[model samples]
Target: MGYGELIIRSYDAQNDRGRVEDFERRCEVGPAKRVFLFTDTLGDPMCRIRNSPIYKMLVAELDSQLVGVIQGSIKLVTVHKPPNDLAKVGYILGLRVAPLYRRRRIGLSLVIKLEEWFIANDVDYGYMATEKDNEASVKLFVDKLGYAKFQTPTILVNPVGHRRFRISPNVELAKLKIEEAESIYRKFMSSAQFFPIDIGNILRNKLSLGTWAAYPRGESWGEVPSSWAMLSVWNSGELFKLRLGNAPFSCLMYTKGSRFIQKLLPCFKLPGIPDFFHPFGFYFIYGVYGKGPLSGKLVRTLCRFVHNMASSKSKDCKVIVTEVGGSDTSRLHIPHWKLLSCPEDLWCIKALKNEERENLHELTKTPPSRALFVDPRDV
Candidate 1:
């Protein structure tokens, strides 16, 4: 039988030890960056998906050889059509196919099964992200699948240890408890893309260090502040290192042109190669929003304090980052890596239903999710 007859099934933890190695190998050769592979560091590939309350992981096997895998979550997404409208949606990520098993419809099969999962969960919409330059991935989602090119969002990365941030003395960084943070998020940032309605659960997660708010010092407790900004720190230590020389990519390619045989046994490994993934954990600053003229100042203070907190926690955690759609005006607030950044990556999506809803215009249309919010967990 052809590879098309491969058996597709939910992840099998006890019987899939070798597949984890194969999965990581595929990722090493695949377009997705290795630094983002948190599963590798976690030891068990299925831990995160199995542990998450809303996620599912799937794998493809051909005669007992694992060839492909995919996973997703049923999410309640917030949109900007009517501004702050909510929709039940699904997100597909961690798509991987073994290098030797490409071009046999395995990927399409995995996604088709995932779509079934989406419908089963009662979600009518599905989406996933890919780099703008990755033609293979873009083609798979857009051409093979019926997904439309949705919103393109800029990813802003900040290095915490590079320099000390100078938060204004007048601005106080009040670290709010989970209850306070959720209450504040509900009031101000409800319109953001994927703004968690269950924000309390997110804040209380073990990975979340805490959440903070920026406001004028000595301000009285009120329903809301005139000039304010809010952000939460998430620990990404589980994603370990993928350095230049040590990474599988470096071994498979040469810095200069070489014969085909040389490519096969390339020992490209060498000392002094820089590590792409952070040694210290990464702190993702998300749910950032501001209002009024003083909002800019409030935002800066929050970033600085977040940096300070990360620094004090340990020497290893240094990078901080966030993503907002290109059309979102809120991007003007945070200090990001000006020289180093991904311009805007596309979020490809499709609806599981036959009928199109009016409130989901931004999500289903061509221009797509202009002011959408990108949760750190989604990354």
Candidate 2:
């Protein structure tokens, strides 16, 4: 496999779907030791990026066979820097190489090609996320590609079981209309880094079930409550299924034991862990915001609402997932199982132009704020 023999080209769904799907299956995520996971995109390789403002997918070929693939999207986002609080950014995701092609530079070539496209589109910066322990990915992006380690976010995952939570009687929860949701996000979260300029489109998208707000019973959307919390849900379950791999015997036993006890003692209503060894879907929580001393309670109530709604609506949805900056105070309120949550999800970024070097330097030197916005589409 000589470097000269590898070819990179734009992906054509008509001709490449099957091969690309096959490529995705061969690329399992997470470390092999405990629990590796693979995403089943349900035959649509472009499903994740299809909803973005501007997006493209590129495939690497070796001897007419698909060896690697990478996807990217460009959008104007908030950066909160001086002189300009926004930047034209490109997000790099879904990068994968065939199992046999590891260390062959296929992954590197694919990323370079995608970044070239980003530069061509006049994108100021390009960024990506990976597990903190993924040394291969860290080296490729940060060490070789010159991307700086930007932010560490935590992925909080709560399993959706046969458990229902009663909302605090004092808290009033209301579903926000699309217009109301957009207004709330722009008003409260526009200052957050990476806040999308087209949040209205995201809220209106079919995959977005809706946004909900929790506050004191007397307050309403007309007049924002002093102490409140709001969040939006994305139906990621419709986009892909994830299956855990290389499970430990202890985890397996715990799952089985919990379920056995629940079945044997029906009145106890224990929330047994779902069987993660098999494929399962999940709902994603994004645009999380809260304030005031009671905000944490409101956030917890909103999370509970989402859990009960998911449990009642879909058996396929096994988990409710949310990603928050590691330093974000909101993480204290979100419910999650420690065993299933990732405490340090790493994000790396690089400036694509010389003029943007200062901006990049400033961003890297400054610690990430609690307001880092995780785009639901990227998840």
Choose the strongest candidate by lDDT. 2
lDDT of 2 by residue, 96-185 (tens): 888777898899999999999999999999999999999889999999999999889999999998868888899998998999889889
TM-score of each: 0.82, 0.96
lDDT (tens digit, per residue) of candidate 1 on 1-379: 5543589888767877566655764465335543233234345665444424488889998878888888888767675445346667888888888878888889999999999988998886798888887888888999999788777888776765533567678886778889888887887777566675667777888877888778777774365666777778777655442222234665334322233433454464221211244334567777777776788778777887877777677566656777777776667767677633566878877877765455445565645433455565666
Please list the residue runs of candidate 2 whose C-alpha ends up more than 4 Å from where it truly belongs after superposition: 1-4
**Backbone-clash count (model 2):** 0
lDDT of each model, Cα atoms only? 0.69, 0.91
